[model samples]
Target: MPDITHEEWLRRAESWKVSGAHHIDGADEPGGGATFTVVSPRDGRVLAEVADGGTAEVDAAVAAARRAFDTGPWPRLAPAERGRVLLRIADLLEERREELALTVSLEMGKPVTEAYAIELRAVIGTFRWYGHLADKLTDESPHTPQDALALVTREATGVVGAVVPWNFPLTLAGWKVAPALAAGCTVVLKPSENSPLSALLLGRIATEAGLPPGALNVVAGNGPVAGRALGLHPDVDVLAFTGSTAVGRHFLHYAADSNLKRVWLELGGKSPNIILPDAPDLAKAAATAAWGIFFNQGEMCTAPSRLLVHSSVAEQVTDAIVARADALRVGDPLDPATEMGALVSAGHLGRVLDHVGTGLDEGARLRAGGERTLTGTGGSYLRPTVFDRVAPGMRLSREEIFGPVLSVLTFDDLDEAVALANATEYGLAAGLWTSDLSTAHRVSRALKAGTVWVNCYEEGDLSVPFGGMKQSGNGRDKSVHALEKYTELKTTWIQL
Candidate 1:
């Protein structure tokens, strides 16, 4: 496909206007609360006026989900029948690919081309993969010495509350909703207030795909109000959330206080990307490191923000990465040619800037692109930032700065590199760049992260599990492990 110009991208975004306040019980209506503007991060243009839902609305949504799961046909439907509905939703997403991508780009400020190619496509693929796997989930039979019959069954965990971040709204929503629905559970989703349009649109698609009323509901609201209510609701059986580590801890506390509902959180990260001197193709390693940190404006939880370079080629790798970061295009997200887009909102941009200031105060050298704003851009734009000579103890190296900032740290040997990488409290994800078979195997085993990519960065597939360890939060989001989170296994024995 040819690259889309900025003007064309804007036009495409303007053309996608499926408006409503909320989608509850398989229908759309203006929410009870006042309307809020969903602005374009490219130019601060008013993309749409979305309904800002609150506690009452959340209660109603949860009630609807509970009613659907209790008395509706969704949970009673055969696994194959439920799979058909999910497959239909995936097909509908593909049919409206352009609109979905445009809405995502406008809401979250990701490059339009990348949003279409990566985010939307991945969402569709996730639905299809889980849909096919639904039928394969079955109960087990056991043999015993006694004259008795035994069976182990997997049952849906009833109502689920899914709260997704603005970084990858649709894709993350799919991560939570697809498996829940496939496992015969009903879901009420709360999208981030900064970017709720795409998820609302997805709710409409779910209805069109013939999902039962209240099986999938979209409630758009802030974290303090709607998100807190979802986590604390007694009726919600499971809470699946993806956001900052601070908020994840709060959700865990809320779950503990409110009915002890199962909470699955995929939270923050300062993931490390280690590059040993023996790695073949230094240029490729440097480019991958740059993309790993700068992709999606570094808003991803799995983004490799820490670069650990061997002392022998630390200077060489840092120089190459700096050059690549400098070359990244930071402009209107609607422009297909653009590589980086604005942060999700003005407040987030300010927080990212504050982290840059903290880095400078910690005495780290700002090697390139620090505290620079895009000229003539109306949105919350920040230039790609790189810090060199950063020690592991520095705030910038330890904290999860969810922006386009890369911190380069040098290590004298492989053992030190592994120690520095695992020093942080977080263990979401990490990367290694090397060609030596023994070194790669040794380092991959030593890393404390949940997912380790050797010679690659941020590469994910639907078949593999995705989640975090330590302070990054628990419970897998993708793969068959996700199904386990959404289900409960029961064992029964009977005398023959």
Candidate 2:
């Protein structure tokens, strides 16, 4: 499909409707409980009244997933057959590409263009990649005595409880759900209360693509209710979560307090992007620094919120970034020309603004774009903000702001640069822009983040594993390695 005009996108948004009930047993369930109003940050309008799933709803969903895993055909099917089903699901998602994109953009305040290109692309690619990889996996057999045979194989770990955040709802859910389903495990997905529409849509697509009843379920509610129940459920063999570091810790505690199920976390980050004086393209590095923090309104876990620049070129790089930030168009998300959209919600915007205030009070120089904007529309909009001459010890430099807020810190040498970059509690991702191969290799190795980009920020492929170290949480997402999280190894010995 071609790119539509902004007016066309607005027309589609007016006509769009969302699914608001919990999906269980291949159908939508009203849950017979109270509902919560979901407000769009794009225009501060009430989108829908989503079912507020609680422990009872969690129980039903988990029970459905448990039945599917224990006695259903989903787990008993051949790997190749299951692979075909996943491929069909991918095709179905592609078929509803426009609809799904609209749902995501309306629910989460992402640009319609980006929701179509980046978000849907990732979701579709994840399922398609895992589908192709499902049957190609192999088991292992070890050498043994002449009269004996030994075989080691992978088995599905049973029901998976996936709790994903709202920033990139469909993409993050797809990262967990596609791999778990590909590994022959049933799933009970609990999306964030702020953005559950797209996830409910995903559940319907899965059932329509020939998945058996009870194989995949979606429950939408607040974190303390449905998410807590899923984390503490004894029947779920594994729980995969992507959210804040504090929430990630709660899942670990829930695992220990309940069934000791395997818990995999992909948590928060305050990643650093370093620019050396010898960068191959200083202008490009500065532009990317602006894009890195401003993209998705900086609600990304791996957003380069901190920019560490060499002292000699700090002024030049900082000025370039400020210019780019000033040039960014902050407006309606449906407009294809708008580079930055609204924050996810009013509460989230308040939190981010508080952090901005703290930064100013802590003595960081506000370079450009530090206040709220577009108030006439009643949308949760903020300017692309940048703070220069940030000290290493400041709160803005250490905490994961998780917004379109950038902190610029200067370093005199390579040692100080690396030390400053590694100072934060997060180590999810980092970026470096340099021309020298030796410096690139040295800095990339020394950076403590899980993924380090030499000249790019947030560029990734399904072939590489993505996760974090330290307080950023644990385990891997994407690639074949992700399947390991949903499967267990079993060894069988035969004697002749």
- The candidate that achieves the highest lDDT relative to the unseen native structure: 2
Q: What TM-score quantifies how close candidate 1 is to the native fold?
A: 0.98
CA-lDDT, candidates in order: 0.89, 0.93
How many backbone clashes are present in model 2?
0
* Cα lDDT of model 1 by residue, 1-496, tens digit: 3366778877766666768489999998677758778887777888888888888889989999999999999999989999999999999999988888888888888988888899998999988998898898768997876788899999999999999999999999999999999999999999998889889989999999999999999998889988999999999999999999899888999999999999998989999999998888888999999888889998988888999999899889889888987788888887777899889888888899999999999999998788657757788888888999898899999999899999999998888999999999999999999989998988899998889999888787988999889998888988999998889999898888
| Candidate 2 regions with alpha-carbon error over 4 angstroms | none
Among these predictions, the greatest TM-score belongs to 2
User: How many residue pairs clash in each candidate at the backbone level?
Assistant: 0, 0
Model 2 TM-score (2 dp): 0.99
Query: CA lDDT of 360 in candidate 2?
Result: 92
Clashing pairs in 2: none
